[model samples]
Target: MITYNPKDWFTFIFRFHKADTLRQLAPLIIGISVYCWIVAFLELNVFRLSENSHVKNITAMHTLLSFVISMLLVFRTNTAYDRWWEGRKLWGSLVNNSRNLAIKLNAILGHEEAAHRSFFKKIIPMYASVLSHHLHAETTRLALDEHEHPELKNLDTNRHMPNQVASMMFQRVNRLYEEGKIKGDQLIVLNSELQSFTDIMGACERIKNTPIPFSYSVFLKKFIFFYVMTLPFSFVISLGYIAIPVVAFIFYVLASLELIAEEIEDPFGGDENDLPMIKMASNIKKHVAEILN
Candidate 1:
């Protein structure tokens, strides 16, 4: 994310760093430029290859190829964006469902019962916060510290972390029913709320595990690089020195779009562009505390 906006033409041309500035492309760019210069020199002084009828025909074919490559890049970018957007939407649903579960828990637990109400209200949000942290592989330090109840401190278990946290909440709800702290109907309502939370967890896990096919990614990357390398030759005869910068700009734009799509394709990663899992977990903590108070 380069954030600065260039207002003037000078800044616009010079300020934007080429996106394919990756170290892997350095040797490729240098080699291609040298190759192109040699080709141009031969055409101009040595062999006069550009004047050959066959060379003219090959250049025309490359022009059509460039158009096809451009279309492929566009389609690849769109596909990546779809995956990124879908992951974001899933997280958005997780937030809403978590909040709904908390509100329902508070209502069913009976806010008038001081101890049971306070415990259930506080624990419901703790479940969300803990689950969020668990999803991101964070330790539940803050979540554990927030609850005053002794039973919550012992809620820790050895199961899959997020599932373990959810189970803790389920156990607490079961205890409330067994101890007569909540009625049978109230237990049923709380169970439904807990089930919704489980559904959210499952959805997030599915998105995190599934990804775009490896073959498609490999094919697209190969095509983009090949297209970029071949681009300058198509323009060298007509555009001469101008071809270098023009080809670079076009390659940079295509590479940048591809890189961005890669970054967002897995929204759960620790990348800056990834969904802020830590922040969401913290927010769940804050919201739960407010409801308890």
Candidate 2:
């Protein structure tokens, strides 16, 4: 994600970041400007309608519908942001759970049980990296170092990688319990963090698989398009040629909201605004190593 100081208002206002709505909407803005000029010219110069023409009544319709459109856009943007925030929270949970599991394992295992310590250390972070890749639908084998764990060897890439990694961690933990390394209560403590790995994975999958309703998204886009198209008719009588900029600016604002909603709705992707999955995964590795090693 692109990091910036929220307090620096002047920099954000003047500097156009790569994912800025202005860059994406520039072509559409120019097209709307030209369309507005044509509509204004035809109405004022050619048709020469009188001041009391019925077409001017479109302004009242626009004024009334403006509230409705604003409400819809607010809902759309809020829904998308909720998904983005939820994804961040899930990752935050994974980071904490991974550290918690490592700390418990470190305390439970004897110093001579370095093999068990190493296994939990690597597997805990590996689960996070595998989950990050799995959510993106990329090959998760790339996230693993094959030599790290024999249990992780020959992991079926065709199967769900996160589940495979989680299974390995569970099996090792169970083996520790069966071998009398971890007491019953210690196993119970570790179980919560281990189970949470699957819960986090499932929640992330829900966000990645599901999306904003198709019909609703399409309706919003259509509403914005038709609403802006009818705006020139409403403004030409009063705003005249100046309606060119006014109409274009209105389209820019409305369309930009939709564009932002689209980008943030799927927070797992490589978008600059997406949750920082890779960075969080690396932090999980670092934090797990510190606790376990």
All predictions: root-mean-square deviation over Cα?
4.2, 1.3
Sum up the clashes in candidate 2: 0
The TM-score between candidate 1 and the true structure equals 0.78
TM-score of each: 0.78, 0.97
Pick by lDDT: which candidate is best? 2
- What pairs collide in candidate 1? none
lDDT of each: 0.66, 0.90
lDDT of 2 by residue, 30-134 (tens): 998999999999999999976789999998899999999999999999999999999999999999988888887888888899888887778889899989898
Off by over 4 Å in 2: 143-145
Q: Please, what are the lDDT tens digits per residue for candidate 1 over residues 147-249?
A: 4677665555455666766786788789878988778988887788678777877877776677768897888788877777676555666666566667666
Least well predicted 10-residue stretch by lDDT in candidate 1: 16-25
For model 2, give the 10-residue run with minimal summed lDDT.
141-150
